[model samples]
Target chain A: MANKADTIISTLITRSRKPLLDEWLARQATMAGSGAIAADGDVKEYCTRFLAELDTGLAAGEVGDIRGAGWSGMRELLEEVSRSRAGKGFTPSETASFVFSLKAPLFALVQREAGDNAARLADELQSATTLLDTLGLYTVEVFQKAREEVIARQQEEMLELSTPVVRLWEGIVAVPLIGTLDSNRTQVVMENLLQEIVSAGAQIAIIDITGVPTVDTLVAQHLLKTVSAARLMGADCIISGIRPQIAQTIVHLGVDLSVTSKASMSGALELALKRIGKAVVERKARPAAEVS
Target chain B: MDQIPILMVGDCLLVSIQVDMHDQLALALQDSLMTKIVETGARGVMLDISSLQFVDSFIGRLLNNIASMARVLDAATVVVGMQPAVAITLVELGLTLSGIRTALNVDKGLALIRRIIDGEEQAFDRREG
Candidate 1:
């Protein structure tokens, strides 16, 4: 049999969409207060759009199961609203309230129309509650998904930003290592350093690990991979910024430190400059240029 | 029957591989380079692979073979302009090419080869003196 509650609910909404929307939006306005949604006429537009989608969704008399093909439009509209509100920094409760707040106005309309029939009133009320609750929960799900997507994209951008290949001179480039070096991070560092070596035609590359917290065996292996890749690209790589502790750890771990290493960036730069047949010497004190 | 050309520049034999190398072509280049090295009495060999973009284990072995063969003829071999991707692949394949000298580009390769030759000559003179 066709759903009686769906029939009654659709009829009431078709008769009083204007009144229902007005009451629901009034509740939302008070709830929204100084929030981003009601600052303009946007909340009204969303309500109008949602009511229109609800009208079509209920016409097919399948309100008990929103997953049916008939309710796809309603589901799509709620997802859009949830995603946008999530990106706009709305709390989960605030976003779900967009659907939940309609319950008061809808129940009142159903209650008034089903007067003198307690059984009919109970049936429509239960159906309406279930439908609204389902929509609110679905909205929350989409909202969380949107937030996760934003976080994932930001993490990717941070990974790319962390490994910057900076050209230190005509044929010298440097990568300042920070944080822990995992295999994935090492791959990014290796690719970036090799690309810079080819583009800058760099002969000397300095890997500065001053900001790295600790060096484990895996981190050492990752560093070795990057160094080997750099060497294969015909660029000499010098590891600098090894603290006293890191040096002791390296020897204790029995990790090979045969790759040229320096205690500071300046020392590495000095050695690199000399390797390229250059040097940095201070001038005599009377060196000011004059315009006569 | 595509052949790689070996150009003689100054005292070095310059072989810039411009095509994808196959077995026969690689062997031909190796054979002819050995003959050319002997004929010109070149002291250095420069391999400019900057234009070639891809490599496999075969090419890696070919590079090693050419370097060692040139070394046997008393000529130093320097490979230059290895692309980043190719280098990573070669490293992953565990071919370090340790027996060969390397430079960033042709100009640097020429300078490195000159240093290698001059350093050897100076060592010989020092031994005599």
Candidate 2:
């Protein structure tokens, strides 16, 4: 015998598909407060597509077990909707409500169809609630995963964009660090600085931490490691941009940088040039009458 | 069984590590370098390690041993041409390589040794005068 709830739900969905779609969309708009962000025409199309997929899914087999092969079409459609809305900045509740709000209209149809029969009405309502709840939670799961992926990608891009090694002179390179120095970012900074040192054959490297907001013991340790590495590569490292505040923090934290430091980039550059046996001298001015 | 070659340049000994060195090879190089320093009465030693892409703690310690041995034999040692990656790896491995002089390349290393020897000669000449 065909499951009574599945039979009734399949028939209701086929016969009252349009009314069910209209009612569900209206209810979702009010509940989700999504009218400002989502267009009415787009909402209608989504509701229509979801209802068609539901009808096919319910006709395929038992409605209670959503994980079964019968519900694949509906599951795929919900995943698509959840992923797109996640990228669009939709709140978890608003996205899940797209599946949850269908409950009211669907349960009402179940009640009207199974009138004067308490056991039949209860069984149908239980099945409908279970299937819809499963789909709703699945949407949330997919949405959370999608959002995390986006965050991870953006963090990687930020790491790459932040750590840039620049060639300041013929045999000098500089890495101007900005923002927080975490272990992952430190790896990128070390790799880039070392690679540039090899390619440029630089003898001096200036690490300017002027944009670094604060320096703690860990940050100091990372700086020391980079300096030591550069020294090993046969290049002397000069740490510039030692603002008074950072210097105080380093002293207070009892972290020894053990490398040459300067007050600013220009100071460090001057030192780098001197170490490489080069000096930047001011050009002598010509007499104004010589041109005439 | 391959031995690292140590060439004599003027009064200084030059050792360029061109192949990957195992523990035995490093020890052999150190032994050969010490004998060369004594045999030639060398005033300085320049070790060019640009071709060495990696150095574990064993190799790092060996380099330190060579420097210390050269110092005991009255020869100053200047390590030259270390690749950046190798340096970073050494530092990461917690070997600071303190008290060792280093130069950017072979020419700079030669000049440094020359300056050190010249300064010693001038000091000796002042005492004699």
Highest TM-score, which number?
Answer: 1
lDDT string, candidate 1, B1-129, tens digits: 889999999999999998888788888998999999999999999999988877777888888998998888999999988888888877777877777788889998999999999999999999999
Stretches off by above 4 angstroms in model 1 are A1-6, A10-16, A32-34, A55-76, A112-127, A157-166, A178-191, A285-292, B1-46, B49-54, B73-75, B89-93, B120-129
Query: Residue-pair clashes per candidate, as listed?
Result: 0, 0
* Model 2 steric clash total: 0
Estimate, for each residue in B1-129, the C-alpha lDDT of model 2 and write its tens digit: 899889899898999999988788889899989998999999999999989888888888888998998989989999988887788778878998987888778887888899888888899999999
Q: Tell me the TM-score of each prediction against the true structure.
A: 0.80, 0.69
CAPRI grade of model 2: medium
Report the C-alpha displacement of residue A57, candidate 2, in angstroms. Answer: 9.6
The runs of at least 3 residues in candidate 2 whose Cα sits more than 4 Å from the true structure, single-residue gaps closed, are: A1-80, A101-117, A177-191, A210-213, A290-292, B1-54, B69-89, B99-129
Candidate 1's DockQ: 0.64
